[model samples]
Target: MSLRWRLNLLIAGLNLGFLLVLAWLLVNNHRESIREEIEAAHRVTVQMLGTAAQTSSVFGPPDTVMVAFLQSVGRVRANEIRLIGTDGRLLFGSPPSEYKAGRTAPAWFAELMRPTLDATVIALPGARVEVVPDPSRAILDAWDRMVLIVLVGIGFVALLHTALLYALRHLLQPTEADARRLVATTRELAQNREVTRLIHAGVEDERKRLARELHDELGQSVTAIRLVAATIERGGALPVSQGAARIDAIAASMYDSVHRIVRELRPAALEQQDLRAALLDMAREWQLHHPAIEFEMHLEGDLADLGEEPTLAVFRSVQEALTNVAKHAAARQVALAVVRGDAGLDVAISDDGRAGAASLGGSGRGLGGMRERIMALGGRLEAGELPDGGFRVAIHVPMPEGAP
Candidate 1:
């Protein structure tokens, strides 16, 4: 059966059993009290009749007055009135009856009392009286009433209990539904943000690759074609020809412009081979461009062991920092430090240039990009102006296990 039915039945059964026992006890006690009262009344009537007999003997047998008083008492105070002779013969009473000593009661009276029967006997002057009735019948009637009341009370309690459980379930349903909806919405938003970030990073990386290829490969081809044209116009070193000389000068200027453009587009040495060697080459190239600027670098780490993403991020951040220094900072000295920690790698770039934190962002979104990259790898980035009038950028990245 369902829980509700089971609960109701259980409570009803318990209450029924308890009430049945209590009702039986109460009914038994009440019946016993009625029986005792009846017996006491019978005894009082017998005593009064015995007293009247004694008074009649003192006066040598009662006259009309004593007979009238005895008849009145028998009618009002006794449930059974009997007069019997010493030989067991009926004397006078309604339904005159007699019983000899050691005789069985009639079958009809025995059958009338199926369960409990009581009998009380009293003696009169040369007569006897007997009272008989079943007391358990009254107890059974009281027991029936108690059983009805118990069933009604148990039914009411069951209804109330069912209503309480239903209300509690209803209250929980809405809260559970709201919690599930909130979790789903939060998950969707997080996925959307992650996808957006990945797309932006991929787009920027592809654009940089294309710009490098355009400047390095195609620009060189154009420069070579211009030089060839100049050679053709010179006609094998024409003597005293200003036109040929001017064309050669123009071709030379164009070559220089092509070289500058290629370098701006891509650091070719960076893609050539080992990143450490590439960084060294970049430092040499920068020194060539700005002879007045001093460069100091300390690289002590297993640079070959860094993951592809981390390696590229470090290279790009360093390149951007140097570019900022060249474009804005007028200081003469620059320092770069790279190290491999226990779990990852660290880099610090400092410049002793006139332009400090205030001038670090002359061109690129240098620090912002660096921050995003470092955060992606569970790392940290810091940038500030140095005390000696320049800028500093520091980065720490937690690397993969077995990484240098």
Candidate 2:
């Protein structure tokens, strides 16, 4: 009715078919073996009868000897032995009469039973013909039993296969439930985090815009006003020299504020050079800020050449890692490695801080943002505190096809 049922049925059918075929093959093989054995035994008996005839003159009357000989052969061989007199009366041995009453042997078996090439037949002193019951009929009967056993085995195997599928479905039900729940939870968490990240990025962009406006528009107005005030102070417009000097001091203060605002708008170094040069400059600035911590950077490969997105992701990842290390890792030395390979690029930032893996978990949102940025660029980011004490971030970015 359902897909699961159909799948189970299909598998069961295949298994049953295999079992049945195997059973038939085994039955056929057994039947052939039995037939060969019976035929061989028949030949041996014929040889013994012939030997008795040849030795009749030396041993005694062959008729009496042959009667006992035929009986012995019948006892030894699986097939029934029959000695037909001239009138067709069986004088020595015969098969069960019930065998004749059973289903008639097929034409093929009957034809095979009709004797072919004569075997070594022993003659009694009085002369007699020896006949044996068809080995084919006996073999067929054994084969029929074998077929029945095989059918039964196949049925058992089919039952086992069906039961196994049923058991697996039942066992996997709970696991399937857990998987669905896990998927749901992951989706919800991702949506919430995505919204939060977008909001944060928007706020940051807005701040940069405002800072640019302040530096460009407001700073220019302030500079113009300061120039006017300096001109007035230089022209001796103010009665007191101290008052004019105060105006100059205020103008200088305004100029410093403009410089600070311009810096806040964006790092000037980033605009002047590419991402590699920019990162190095930022590292130098970070080291200036955190003089106690040692910063080491090694740039290998062609990182300076990359798409805007990938380059930006790398730059931000480095920035975030360093920022995180500064805030969380109370370490002495920091190592930043950027390796660009043919496949893509790798950036690893490690610090010899007191924080280990456990400490990095709740260290804050910087690592999460770094991870998201890398992920959005089709890269992977791994962040954890190193075992030997300190935090480390490893990032991998896969290059586009044919990208060198």
Candidate 3:
């Protein structure tokens, strides 16, 4: 269940349970109170009747007058009054039983309170008197008050529930907004990454094209100048030959410098082959230059779906990472692996190079640029030091959907 549903259910269930328990206690308590009131009222009324009869009999007259007075007492009470003679045969009034008009409360309510009614018998002036407290009147009043109180309580609880639900919805509104904002931000980042990737790829193409042009145009001119100088030196006088030799030496040096510049500008492997082949060749070239380092090259899955720009981005990122490792890491072994997946490509370059703390991007502009380049291509770059004293760089570039 969602948090909203769970919390609402929990709070609602607890409230309902507590209210039910409270109502149960209240009803029972009200029943007991009404019974007590009836009992107290009966005691007071019976005492008054006894007082009236005793005071009248002592102060008034003889037996004949006493009989008349007893009859008067029975008439005044109007319910039941008994005057038993000495023989227990002739009496001033009927037995003490009263008839009620109708039910004061519902029959069920009366029944519920009947079990707890108290029966009290008392000695009277001239006879035995008994009073059984009937709580019908009080029960009716108590039920009315209780019903009103319960109704008000129920209404209050309903209102409170409604308010709480509203408040809960209001509280979650900001969370909903935050979720929407996060989605938009993520979309913007992806777009920015794609733009950066394309830009970096274009830059690579320019670099390769410039290198090829310089190598073809400037290299041929220098070589031709050297040939001309060599031809003049073989045919001229001793002084002329010495001057020709100087020109030839200058031309040869220029040619060698230009060749080195071209190689530095663009690797032949990348310009001439597929990304995987280019990376393997580059790895071999690095290993050849630093024979002390053990370089492992592992490739998995297909790279045919990746366009030229994405290909260039990945290759350059790997190339820069390797260069940084060779220049700064001071490590003996390097592990480089590329795995293509349905979503994207993953490249990991790890080396046992960190002397103390592991850090990302190394300590130069080169590492920073590599990170930017990768990110611009809608990829991520992460680097850290391993626990066993090594640094690892990881790159992930998201591929387009449904690419083979």
Candidate 1 local lDDT, 73-138, one digit each (tens): 544232455555557875544332232223433444224323343545545455554444332333
Query: All models: lDDT?
Result: 0.64, 0.69, 0.70
Quote the lDDT for 314 in model 2.
79
Quote the positional error of residue 68 for candidate 3 in Å.
10
Put down candidate 2 lDDT per residue, 223-311, tens digits, no spaces: 76676677666775555555556666766877766665555345565454366776877787788779999888899876655777787
The per-prediction CA RMSD against the true structure, in angstroms, equals: 13.7, 14.8, 15.2
Off by over 4 Å in 3: 52-115, 122-129, 175-180, 189-404
Off by over 4 Å in 1: 1-273, 341-343, 354-364
Where does candidate 2 clash, by residue pair? 49-122, 50-122
How many Å off is the CA of 316 in candidate 2?
1.7
Q: What is the C-alpha local distance difference test score of candidate 3? A: 0.70
Residue 312 of candidate 1: its Cα lDDT? 72
Name every residue pair that clashes in candidate 1.
331-353, 331-354
Q: How do the predictions measure up, each by TM-score?
A: 0.44, 0.43, 0.41
